[model samples]
Target chain A: MSDRATLSTVAARAGVSPSTASLAFAGSPRVAPATVERVLRAAGELGYAGPDPIAASLRRGRSGVVGAVIGERLLYAFRDPVAVQMLDGLTEVLGELGVGLLLLAGDGGPAPAQLGRLPLDAAVFATCGLEDDPAFRLLRARRVPLVAVEGPVVAGVPLVDIEDRQGTVELAAHLRELGHRRVAMVTMPLRLDGRRGPVDADRLATGVYRDTRERLLGAREVFADLPAVETASNGIEEGEQAGAALLSGPDRPTAILAQSDLLAAGVLRAAAARGLAVPGDLSVAGFDGADLPWLAPVRLTTVVQPTAEKGRAAGRAVVALLAGEVPPDVVFPVVLRPGTTTGPAPA
Target chain B: MSDRATLSTVAARAGVSPSTASLAFAGSPRVAPATVERVLRAAGELGYAGPDPIAASLRRGRSGVVGAVIGERLLYAFRDPVAVQMLDGLTEVLGELGVGLLLLAGDGGPAPAQLGRLPLDAAVFATCGLEDDPAFRLLRARRVPLVAVEGPVVAGVPLVDIEDRQGTVELAAHLRELGHRRVAMVTMPLRLDGRRGPVDADRLATGVYRDTRERLLGAREVFADLPAVETASNGIEEGEQAGAALLSGPDRPTAILAQSDLLAAGVLRAAAARGLAVPGDLSVAGFDGADLPWLAPVRLTTVVQPTAEKGRAAGRAVVALLAGEVPPDVVFPVVLRPGTTTGPAPA
Candidate 1:
């Protein structure tokens, strides 16, 4: 190739053995730092992209890949503060352990079509709303050790979950105690099969995602007969749309319980658009108590789950599994964090 | 070690040659798919993480590491939407090609202490933030093929840049067209040295980062005397803080131009806090045109840069450089998009 040089040529130019050049490329701590530096300088002068890993991988039959199986391709899944925070926490743990994350997004993470052929040492299941995703089924087929985060309680797969149901119950009770009788809820997807319209009684039973199912039940357990709507994804816009649709009619709810902070935010925006006051005219609560500091003085009354703890638990489980120890599935507790978005029911 | 099984051992247990087992792992198009299925079924029974990549890396002299050098901690860098989107796009492209990414985030990439010790074939310079990052100096000394993204414009290192200056200028002109002369600005960090606060006439002379300097000049060219408040990072909260401070004092500009969409979101929040109706009371604009469907109805009047194109260009550059070609520096174009956030100056 015109201006480019291969590792062999770089080594030849540096007057070192090809093995030495290889050592330089690996950044092997064992190599004398000076010699590695010299090889790199020579390689740079020769216009090489260090070593071609594709060629090496063909021979070695291994690629340092850790797949992150995400359920959908919605843009918010990546930018949602809560999702990003959880990912950051997980990445912190995995990166320290010398692992890199391959975000295998949409349709069971990086193409369910290549169930067995994908190069991954292990796979972690990451999804936003609690929905029936095929991440478990596909990774299972590949024999990849599975670590599910905030999803169904799948057998044989280790899990990292939060106390989502209990947290919602506490939030609903809190809203009721604040003088709210006519309450409503904005729930996550009720079942798989990618349903996005109005949720019904039968769909609730067939809910595939554990968290969404539990949270909805928790809300019902609190208010007995609370009005509620379901959104396609956990997003502010979806929440706002749901809020608008629910609140548009004459017999509207006084308080709204959203499964996620983004949904709650949308509800707040909807209320604002309709000239309703947050606490004076309406009350709203959210889950995944993330810091929406930009929401300013209007804080969100919600549940705070330990995201980093979830990541650490997953990491510990991976380490244990690798060490041949059966790691028990972990369920981290959630705390009721009341903020300013909620108050007395509408007068 | 422990439960980790190498491909050779799996091959032995399956009573097949290591190469055959490797072929099974590859699932090559030429290989009989049935043979591939059987080899996998056997490998599954042996309790293997497929192949011990750490061991294979040592033996093969190449690690499938396309190390991306980020200027801050992984958490901080990963939080930014722009960085995350670029990473998402880059990974999407590389994943299809079986190239794994190692997000090596720290001042410039990895520290000098880590430069010679990472298993990277070629390193991509990610968000190094236009300073004399020690990481780049070390990568230079070590001769790692540096591919800078929206960073320093080193002579030899291949750069992947978006039209930041042009984009901002177009945005500023749109504001100008709307009859807004007293426009305020919020910018990304002016220097990699962390000397953040305000970039006045004096600081502009000693500006360090090429991208920052270019973007500032591009905006300045439109409104040369316009004063811009410098933010510590390109985040929403920071933008909100900047907006609150700027909008509070004397003669807050009718239009505020933010360098990033996240920051623009913050500014919108700040405006909301003050009961300022967007477009009705204040005209606002931003860059990077991030997906803001969540901030819907009030679509952002911003510039849209080709994010996926930039990532694809970087991927293609790496491929070409690997194939021994002089990959040219790529600077993608931008388009000015008008939305609900901007309107004619209030009467």
Candidate 2:
């Protein structure tokens, strides 16, 4: 490592000033092409590589890396199409900005102790309900610009959120319009700890996950006595379990509203297992209009939130925060996409 | 910014040595409790946060970040279950090691110019056939430790590769044993450029992507005159298009072997579009035993690679390389999972 050559050595070998050498390596037009060639030749002779990133970052006061704090484990998070699409959009913006994405997995609060040493210009809390996250506290202590995608919004940190409540309300109303009086719900985790099973009234009213709480509230407005089962995670298997619990009973609901498309897919699977025809025996509606191409022939009736756009919005907020400008909190709209899965309630 | 408190200032205010002040911040047990408390009070008074990450990195000579270069867009890459599963595995290891994952999207060759300024201690060429990748050259020039997940296995860089040829040969044999005389292949991209259309003999012999080429060769060993269609991307839609192109022709084969399960799903969709029954009209086989829950009841007959294990092996190699130890290249085995998609050809 000591044998490694520096820009100064290259400059000295080229008989050029250090600044000129730097300019040549940076591809600056100020340096003459012939002089650049000479510097390159010297660099080749001395086995000097390009400018070191550490030195460059020190000079610029920027790490050229943005940390994306994912709340859940990578295995579970990557399984969700909504999360994947959002991440894809965020990567698009960050990639175009020339900054690499540094994934930081957080469990609700502040990052792990290991992240204490990482140099991040800004951090995006991609998961929801992070107000109590210890990682968040640590990042705040580091004075890095922070952006939240959903909830527990922190002061001074700009937020990019979706209208989660409105989407559920519309879907529930659509079901009500079809004369579905008995409806059961499958919900996202009430908190980051992944508590599952029958959700009581008190838990529903005081849940930590803002998106889940808000969506549940919206659904309650339509069906005042709608019972819900919270899942351990937003996955098809969990959805299936929740669906089985709800549909196996003697008094089954005519319609089921799931928080995500993947969960709705699970519900569909449970229905199939019981030999129940969709929209005939049960009507299932899901949120997050994810393109489940494999779930063919049965397009889900869902509220289409702009998943990618939400991510891009978060990316924009990050850019703004980095530029020393405060970005306003954003709340994207959601639309109801009627598909073959939902229809008039069975007489 | 200029008035921000330093460790020296806190030390001076606390009337303690700077070394003690540093130890207090680092939570070192060497410092007396009273001295640590004094240093903390001084730090609080001065409004000093923890030590700066950039400064710490410069002192330690490690960025605490590892770059994983994916040679494709995140959107397209995330669509493939195999890629997602592998990434999930890699992240699990890196997380335990206390290093943040820096996602670097590469376009087959060099990284974008912006990436040159990003600080990375080591780089993983996680994508395939990156011998000529510009980013690879840059990382090598920077003296960063390198790990490859697959081919173009560099001389010193330890590689983690799967037995790409064996699985395909086994699957093709299974198809042949079913008395299938005619077979059509839907292959992954022969190159990163995603050229889709009829695949000829010369193109097959001189393909750039090693995995695609090896799989093609494996299939050819059984069906010497096997015709194929190459897809532009490793996506269900691309597979669907390729499938439609092959299955819609006048002289359709008795069986179609897709290079990936996602593509096989597309072939299934195409079959559904044409009202063809599986194993009755056409027997389909696929590679990469991914869990396609949405493709329910029609379990795919495919080759199952240990995707997660492959990623973990690469991660281990990275750990070894960073520790100044040379690790041997690893080749993981594949298994043939016979599912409902393939059976005896129609009589």
Candidate 3:
């Protein structure tokens, strides 16, 4: 085996103790300037790149990395503006804490093996369904600090949740006040299996996703027996597909409530393709107050959740857990934002 | 110190050797299933979560984490559909490789300290200026395998480059053929300093970002003295601000070529705000064949670079470097896709 140079070799070459050499490499003020320069010169000659970060991390007992277990594939999670905004906020706080954010795939992708072997100081269940997650169980077994965003409550795992149910209730109420009696719903995936179509009772009973179930239940509270379609994903195209399915029927509804802003945008496109004018022919409302600059002239009436704030809260929770403190669960409130997309239904 | 449960403790309780206990925990077929059950029962009673991943990584001499140095803030990078798509592709491959992706902020955010301490087997400069990067020097000094995506070439570092310069030339040629003598450009940041406004000679000379410089040079090759504006970031709002600056001037160009699709979308919005009809009054083109579903009805005339392919190439390069093999540099070709936004210059 090739003998790689170590700190002791550099220390011997520099005529300094190993501790002093370590101090010089760490830029400790206790080391004299001349000795530090000599140690660096010796290291340069020996091709020693300070200390192996892995070894140093072992000594510190912290990896300085926080893993974010995203529920969907990175492409899907990133495409969603809400997820991006939350990640942005989370990363901002993690940056301030001098830690790196490591992206780990959740149940939707190949994550099981990587989750078992990767060194993480804490793991955040960002944008994943809370129930029966294998990644959560693995991380918990490893005794890693855990945090979740918008999921069902798990004991000892702090959550950065939002008023998902209440927000949907408010949105449904707004459409009702607008005199829209017949309403249909376009939802995010009811489960992680990526199934799309009508939301039958069988699908509902087996639904494990917290946000999807809560939002559907909330809408049901206002319009009992509201016809709904479940999208394969929370995207514009999926929303459009769901919209077409509802509109093609002879008993087309006046309003469509989508679980995400991207889905609502798709539904609007579907309506436009079918020669339906929003507010005149159909009313649409969406969850997540995402800033869609391209969807101009026609603003979306949606439930505005504090997406970034939720991410920051998750980051803080991780920080607190790492510091050996149990962080309080954070639940952010959502508000109903009325826009051009929703108004009085056609008489 | 408290006596924490170790592999030895579990082995002692299970009446098996330490190696056998470890093999059992790893679910190795060599270990008898009966022995594995005994080990698990012992582990459950003692509260041992397999082995410490950090120590295991030290023994294996691999962290199984690839660091991606993003040039901008996570929020801004995620907002750009091109970056998201590339990340999606990169993660897909990394998932197969059983490696976790650690997101490291480039010179744009807080990253230096975290970079030094994080245990990364390899690092990819995903979207950043290649010149004078402290993170690059740090990683290189640590002897970590390195790859860059669309940046200036460095010795021994393979790049997954796109035809950035050639793509712009094609778009510019298309515009010139359409009788656009006067054309302006909106660029991604010429430098990472977050400066915006009219691109001055000083900004042009000090430009460090390779994509921005290459694309500008390509446009200059076609339209020598093409007026240009630089954006603070590659975002729609930034693009709109730059577009407003370009259009508000007395000498408005007949066509505006944006370096990115998001920026192009913003420029289109700016033109709409000014009541200028696309193709009839002005022509707009963008780079990066990003899927902007929201920007429907008005297809952007731009260069379509294989963005996700670039990301996959980078991932392949990282995999190669980790396997102690030198990977070949990959350069993807781009094509011009003419859309409704570009047309003959108005008389």
Candidate 4:
């Protein structure tokens, strides 16, 4: 253990005034890089951890709080690998700029119970897909500059989104190319709330789920008449429900396209339970490039979204917005991964 | 669009002083419960988004920076579902206190680049089973109150650990009960750092991975002479490496126990490639109650840790330390879940 050192010790060691050293670490451009390095080295030697974030935030009139809105509660959010990856990207970017992440758990509902009431400088959340995503409502009510991800685009709000429609379009096209005609789609919710059951014509007509709508639209672009069964949540159980309903009915589709990897896995489960041979008897696909190792020997043919990149973009959007610049809407490209799941339509 | 309302307006409407309204909304002890509700209603009507977090943090003299040292970069951390679950737990608890998470990336070297450089008030990391993680070194140097998960208890730092040994003991006992004599163990890094090859008596004596060490110790309590092959990392590739090493070896064990579910999945992949039958030729078990919907029909028999709870405990520990209280160590229990992967050892 070392004795706690202060900023003055670092300044003295660096042969610079305390103010100069302070400016360097404070991300001031006026300070020369060489000077900054010198101060940093000195601080490192003295074990000085730099300026207090609380004090600095007060001086800047900013909270330095970067709230990340998960579409669901802690249990659900943690279960989704894609969401975690996105958060990882966001956290990495925010770390560089001395910002902190506030994970606002917005399970099934719009937001966490206390999210809107918490102090936050900016937020990255989903408004369209969530039931009551408090991030948007709270930030919107507070007039806080926000950057949404895979969610609704409120007028004047910037976003870090992906080509959800294009990704699914590519997925659907690939499935179609594999000689698939009858295909069932498992979708995320179709609205801001968690009213999960069936996706009627009315839900599609008045689509509200941002991620779901985009992907559904993309699938429809390729499979114009494909029937989509809605899932309550992104979990596998919900996916299995949609799968059972679709597979159990008469004149079952030859293929199934799940909105998420979890749902795709569930569809596989449903197919297996129904005694359907995978790829040979039924083909299943999913979105989101998650590592489903337990599904070993079986690769899912799906569209892979760069979740971390999306998060980084969101973080960048927050930084830019904080810096008084409106970030252009960012839509990352998704790659269509051809795996073992989708094969030529059964004879 | 709604106007950004302030506490002053809520106070004015509630016919109270600004301080009273602020206290009410802040949920301070000074304010009566009824008065807090009154203020909350007024603020809700006015669309006020509670007190400014930045301002509150400033007044508290802490940035709420709880340095979370993950094993690798941001992307890598997100890739691990278990890690994400734990983090999600931590975030939920911290959110309640308005605390922010500062992610610290670790390369598990003598001098961790990100951890040493980042300005953090306190840190939570694990014993990487390496010589000593650079993140821990820097955090120690800075005298930050520390909380470790899945690592050994360092002096002055509270350990948020699990019953890795107990769970592994139970797992081995279960295998024995199921009629297994020759059993093998596939494990995460035996050393805190890199590829340490196999976990024989010599290497096991100097193993760096705390969880691996403990679990192996517990398994040995039952098996006594279970041959162990160590993986380079927690991913499927590493698991495959160990799996290949195990299967290719002359004395093939009837059953195998993998340290992680992902690694166990890799073993299953290797088995499939080798034309081996699961639960017939070789029954396998793993740790961590992870979601593997893609595995479809095959579930893993493994030890499940309360990842979210571990994270929540870490978050609570940080909050407690930040508030000048020395919290006790939290040891979460791990359960042995018998999935389809593990069955009767052999005929």
Predictions ranked by DockQ, top down? 3, 2, 4, 1
What fraction of the true Cα-Cα contacts (under 8 Å, chains A to B) does candidate 2 also have? 0.45
Instruction: At residue B56, give the lDDT of candidate 4.
Output: 63
Judged by DockQ, which candidate is best? 3
User: What is the lDDT for B57 in model 2?
Assistant: 80
Per-candidate DockQ vs. reference: 0.22, 0.49, 0.60, 0.34
> What proportion of the true contacts does each candidate reproduce?
0.10, 0.45, 0.61, 0.27
Identify the leading candidate in terms of lDDT: 3
lDDT of 4 by residue, A1-347 (tens): 65456677789999999899889987799999999999999988886776654556566766556666665665666567787677777776777765656555554222344555445678888323543344566677777787878666666778777888888988999988989999989997775356666577898777656788778888989988788888767888888889999998898999999999989988988998989998998999999988666576688888898887888888889989999998899889999998988899998
Q: What TM value does model 1 have? A: 0.80
Candidate 3 chain B worst ten-residue window by lDDT: B105-114
Against the reference, the lDDT scores of all candidates come to 0.73, 0.84, 0.88, 0.76
Which CAPRI category fits model 2?
Answer: acceptable
Ranking by lDDT: 3, 2, 4, 1
Task: Give per-model CA RMSD.
Answer: 5.2, 2.3, 2.4, 5.4
Candidate 3 runs further than 4 Å off: A23-41, A107-110, B1-3, B23-41, B107-110
The CA-based lDDT of model 1 is what?
A: 0.73
Clashing pairs in 3: none
Query: TM-score winner among the candidates?
Result: 2
Off by over 4 Å in 2: A28-34, A107-111, B27-30, B107-111
